[model samples]
Target chain A: MGLAKRIIPCLDVDDGRVVKGVKFVNIRDAGNPIEIAQRYDEQGADELTFLDITASSDKRETMIHVVEEVAGKVFIPLTVGGGIRKVADIRKMLNAGADKVAINTAAVANPEFVKEAAEKFGSQCIVVAIDAKRVNAPSKALRWEIFTHGGRKETGIDAVQWAAKMVNYGAGELLVTSMDRDGTKSGFDNELNRSISDLVTVPVIASGGVGNLEHLVDGIKEGHCDAVLAASIFHFGEFTVGQAKKHMAARGIEMRID
Target chain B: MNTIAVIDYGMGNLHSVAKAIEHAPGNCKVIVTHAKNEILAADRVVLPGVGAMRDCIGEIKRLELDYIIQEVSKSKPFLGVCVGMQALMEYSAENNGVDCLNILPGHVELFDANMTNAQNERLKIPHMGWNKVTQNSSHPLWQGIPQDSRFYFVHSYYVRTNDNNHEAASTDYGVKFTSAVAHENIFAVQFHPEKSQHLGLKLYDNFIHWDGNR
Candidate 1:
């Protein structure tokens, strides 16, 4: 049996509540993290990722509690990100029922932390999240640059080079978000995804810019992503995880149907 | 009431494993504990592991869990998951090669850097996500789980048994390797049943009902 392409639904949790703003009914009801997670799980989502967008000191405890509460009910793998800086932060998340922890700003701040975290908690549980934006300037040879602090800052590090470095640092997986295409819903930045996917040997999860099932199909087929992570599309009831799987299946893509 | 003790060596996600067992259809009481007495008293034992082999063995040896696992595995129905299954082997090439429990006749090998699947596609390392497991033996764990049922796996290394008789299942990832191993009272899998949806849950259910004799 071949490895099935993963379709992940991402939830942006701000201050213990799921962030709203995506055009959909009961967006208020979707605020309940547990309910949203349960719905996705029931719909047969391959996995779930919760990014704590709050990234505040006070909200850390709340986020941990949210992870614990959601993890208690959801049987699938849960990946928690945002505000994770040190190994201690990763430990707290794991102890709180997170199967894997995604590090972003911290990895950019201290490149060695990736290796340290991978060493302490096995590379399998450490996922390096890279927020990349395409460089429009013609002078730059690299197509993308790594951004941090929720895409508010750029590190000037070549995106492809950084991807290779993280793998060298023992990162087992990569969650790459294309800021250029994120929230746009036009489609996944296939060029950026393909570049990073080609540079790294680990599984690359294509995040951002998914408006429909076709976008997801593009992410896996053209971009060569191991998985696809979308927010608004799944969060606003644009498409169910089952519907996405059906589309991928019809396209001759291997997926876990059950 | 029968108790299923999930061994916690401070390495992997013990709660998730315990939660799955708690949800399994049975009258069994699922306990997540590192206590020697509790583990020894349980009707069945589950060794759930993740993380590097060195740290896993470090904690296992430090807590004297290695002795307990070896002791309980012989008498009761024992199940191992991921690194837990790998730890039972003689040695692992991970972390520049480390010695394992040697309970099973095999050694863990890392997926080759240049590994390619039958389709000649360059396979990704760690081999994450769901893949079908082809059962090779008539073990009780395969009772309800369909043939070639998908199971969730996340590992860069795979096991190579010295004897094919102990190999319960095999899966393809660039190369077909042993995915599940069964020898006498023990049944172990490389996949995380806790994360593998309904099909995975069925394996756990079968484990709870399985007699140690098989």
Candidate 2:
């Protein structure tokens, strides 16, 4: 209730470094995760989250070092995700200093994982990350389906309804990444964003397809969600969080300017 | 020569914050530290973070950085960025319920799932990307930073401070949570000034030159 719309910059990590993939292909290294996170932190980023892309590889312990290194240098709330398939994994992440644990495929595979994590860590520490894609024809009943395995497989789960279930299972927040809008910058899938945000009780973070500032405003005011997440635009330094907030203010969207 | 020593907990990205501060006209010297002496003598203080609030808070306690922060912020220009900003809260409900510096009043809890509404669906977790910052009051940090100037955000939980007067900025994530706050000589933002490009650096510049009048 303090402000409207949040802007976030993401760093997709592979092998303890920052890397970006074009449609999850042709991967390119950005820099050391710690260094890159420092750069984003100084640019007036509200918070920092790390997605250990390699977490699925089962080298989970290594991500802790990454988190430790980055957390030591920067002074922001940091969340870590990827390969978080178990409550014990969540405990390890927390012990490693992660503020929140984001789980996707694992939560879907064992729905009880959501409830268990929530019961153990509190709903505030459990974040349900859903990777969703919009099919060609949008059916009113269930047009969006949950995609897992780095968004390669569809779970046939309704993005809207599944989000509600996560909350029921004691999810503190939802990080929704639009597979279609991801990295495209065509703008966020506002239709999907608004719908999910309107449906969920917990705060919803709209992800993917943020080419510019207007998209962020649309995601917050139009989408009526709690936060907006992006990468390329910020990673490339195309625009700063400050500029985007100014634009949002112009649109009458509440934001933290200074 | 009041220096603003940034707390280096062995996890965050500090170089960028330092570089951004140096980029600005803020005369205050910005230096990353795990030492106490540097913190005690500084005219201003800054804490920028990435990674876990639990770890940062732990390191601060482990290294006895909290006392230094409290001591400095009591009379000097104190600032916290990102997780650093959240550390200023009373406690973090994330990661084994970490106890924070408690410098700023209020606790930061995760977005309650039970709080979600049932009518909508679309947005998702991690709350990453760029978002607007709503200014609720006038402060030195806002001198040049335009209203709605976006700041990069990447956290799911936000600070829920109770003091309305301390709040300087707010961002929506399900519900509005305190984003930027000012208490006497202390000023903290949930956004990163270094990574925020020009507008964010401008705030840092303002923080450097803040006379504490506005």
Candidate 3:
């Protein structure tokens, strides 16, 4: 009886609809947020994260409604990320029933925003999302730089140092995504995850690449993440959240298997 | 009809908590309110909170909820969650030591910064995510919920009752801490039952029908 490493299924929502193809044979509606959320909840997903990728501000209200609908049915922690820019944005999502909101570019634009959000809304409900890619440094030492705008724009900030700074700024949790391995079906950047996980006292959620259940296990075992967040594998019906938990538990990783 | 009043002192989000209670297999109405009369009139009261202990206590006092909470807890079935559980303690080490409601005889302490598990790996603060909670004593809230059920937890500090008899459950996270407490009509937990899925909803259902008796 101990703390179980979590397996979070992330749904990338674009204008209120789930962006990925959730090819679950049983699920009739693929893009419906509530159905997808309920499916994950039934599969024993420890938590659900909805990353709002909608580009237009006018359609952002759709994400809020999606959250409201999902939170009503799915009885688990829900985290909404992607476009959180200010304190009001955080409040709106929380009011919409999101357990936490992930702040990315805004924290980079003004690091004080993270501090202010944490102060106003409490650190427990604030998550800092970091998109990092490996950088070619002069020395042989491993170095990764922070990227914003969905890993498109580079900030030139050191990822590890920025992680520690965010924790100092009162971020309750850090969602570290590896840009290099993301979308590659490769495993997470264990080295990148371990560096930040070891440096910060807060829980580090390993995100990005996760092709199979083994990648999820590696996230906890090798990456030293407190939780593993994956998008494609779970959304594509390649593996269920229950299957991943069972596999992780079989691999000697503590999992909350129902 | 039984009503569950979720004391909302302008802290963290209470929607999920209220929604969870309403979703439970009960016909009760759950209202999130800071109004003392509404809370006192309800048969069950739930104190749901998050964030720092200082702010929780500060807001409770500023709203003059201290008296209301003390008054209702003595006679009604009350449940405290996360920082709400910590707030019932005498004091807390968070925010450089802040005093609490003292409704429960205990103190809240931060997880040791240098603490490690048996693997010698450093344990993270804010011990986030799901953890198995071992029921120390049987209570109405534990009804139907199996022992050692995993529940969602997200907090940096933990509570320790001055008396062990007050403890209802314990969870291991590098240390065996008091995860839940039961005393008379009051039951509190360090974990977020609202986010614990089915087992969590079961606990809420049990609380709804619990009649403040052993």
Best-fitting candidate, scored by TM-score: 3
Selected candidate, larger DockQ, 1 vs 2: 1
Q: Find the 10 residues in a row with the least total lDDT in model 3 chain A.
A: A21-30
TM-scores for every candidate against the unseen true structure: 0.96, 0.59, 0.97
Give the candidates in order of lDDT, highest first: 3, 1, 2
Summing lDDT over every window of 10 consecutive residues in candidate 1 chain B, give the lowest-scoring window.
Answer: B113-122
Ranking by DockQ: 3, 1, 2
Off by over 4 Å in 1: A20-29, A139-142
lDDT for A110 in candidate 2 is 94
| Residue range A124-201, candidate 1, lDDT tens digits | 998999999888588755488999988889889888889999999989899999887777778988888899898789
Alpha-carbon runs more than 4 Å astray in model 2: A55-58, A136-142, B1-214
Winner on lDDT between 1 and 2 is 1
Q: What is the lDDT of residue B176 in candidate 2?
A: 73
What is candidate 2's lDDT per residue for A155-207, written digit by digit as tens? 88888889889998988788899898787779888888777777766678788
Please tell me which predicted candidate would have the highest DockQ against the true structure: 3
For residues B76-136, write the lDDT of model 3, one tens digit per residue: 9999999999999999999999989989999999898888887788888888889889998
Between prediction 1 and prediction 2, the one with superior TM-score is 1
Q: Model 1's CAPRI class?
A: medium
What does the lDDT read for residue A23 in candidate 3? 26
Per-residue lDDT of model 3, residues A160-195, tens digit only = 999999999999999999988876678999999999
